[model samples]
Target: MKYTRILTVGALMASLAACSAGPAGKAELCESFDQLGTQLLSGNGIGNPLFRAADSLGDVAERYSAQNLGSDAKSLHAIADSDGTDSNELRNATMNIAKICGHPLGLG
Candidate 1:
């Protein structure tokens, strides 16, 4: 089911990309990415929040992947791309992202 969701998101993003064909489309995509991140951070409850976070993470990843930002997807892709996975930078970045999104991961 998780895999399916990922595929679906990827497909959806691709379709969106096709429809949006200029600077305006890029701005809209970027806004959607930011909004999704915000939604992830604002999740309430305990376990439910984690699940929502996971889902939002996936969606954000898809958006970032669509952006084709390479290793510079900022805080979120730092860990995934393993550019700072072994250092405190990754942890700090992760925490900052969570905090910026209005969710504190408390892993720092």
Candidate 2:
């Protein structure tokens, strides 16, 4: 029984570690930004419900090792979280991260 508990605890810790291991590389971060861009750059942009869920993106950004990446993500997420966030600001924030990730996202 004690061994079982230890194994379970070990498994949980491993899962947590894996979850915390942010993007594998710049490519991964760019992919994440791409998803956000799709939702944000849409006609609805901030009006969309998915835009509200963008706050979790910062958690991933924070886990990234790059210097400006996290801050850029923070700016995007911060603007996203703001009550009066505008589409232009959102576009700019997304562009900043996209530029850093080398995957510039253009709006449709």
Candidate 3:
């Protein structure tokens, strides 16, 4: 019973710590999403940086949707997945992401 109590207390403390380390703030999340979008849009081809941008956008998309940019985030992912051979798609997606993030990177 004592060990069980100690375990429960430890679990509670861990959960509290996790709760304190919450998600990034709205401005930060939006800026990160915009930055990744810019990188993907500027990429010359489907390379490491492009793939990294896509991967990062996956996380950004989740946070963006939480902040009510669900349609833009989904569109961003779709463009990322489909724009391997066409920068125009990426450019359009970047514009949408920038508009949603309110931090345009001047892709147009």
Task: State each model's C-alpha RMSD to the native.
Answer: 10.1, 4.2, 6.0
Instruction: Write one digit per residue (lDDT tens) for candidate 3, span 1-108.
Output: 999999999999999977744664566566666666567566645365764665456456556534555555566566556635345555555565566556554332
lDDT of 1 by residue, 1-108 (tens): 999999999999999977643333334434434553454445444544433333334344344423443222355443444422322443344443443344444321
Comparison by lDDT, 2 against 3, better one: 2
The estimated TM-scores of all candidates read 0.27, 0.60, 0.49
Model 3 lDDT, residue 42, Cα: 68
Where does model 3 exceed 4 Å of error? 1-24, 41-47, 83-85, 94-96, 106-108
Candidate of highest lDDT = 2
Better of 1 and 2 by TM-score: 2
Ten contiguous residues minimizing lDDT sum, candidate 3: 83-92
For model 2, give the 10-residue run with minimal summed lDDT: 44-53
Candidate 3 matches the true fold with a TM-score of 0.49
- Of 1 and 2, the candidate ranking higher by lDDT: 2
Q: Give the TM-score (vs. native) of candidate 2.
A: 0.60
The better-scoring model by lDDT among 1 and 3 is: 3
Of the candidates shown, which would achieve the greatest TM-score relative to the real structure?
A: 2
The C-alpha local distance difference test score for the whole of candidate 2 amounts to: 0.62
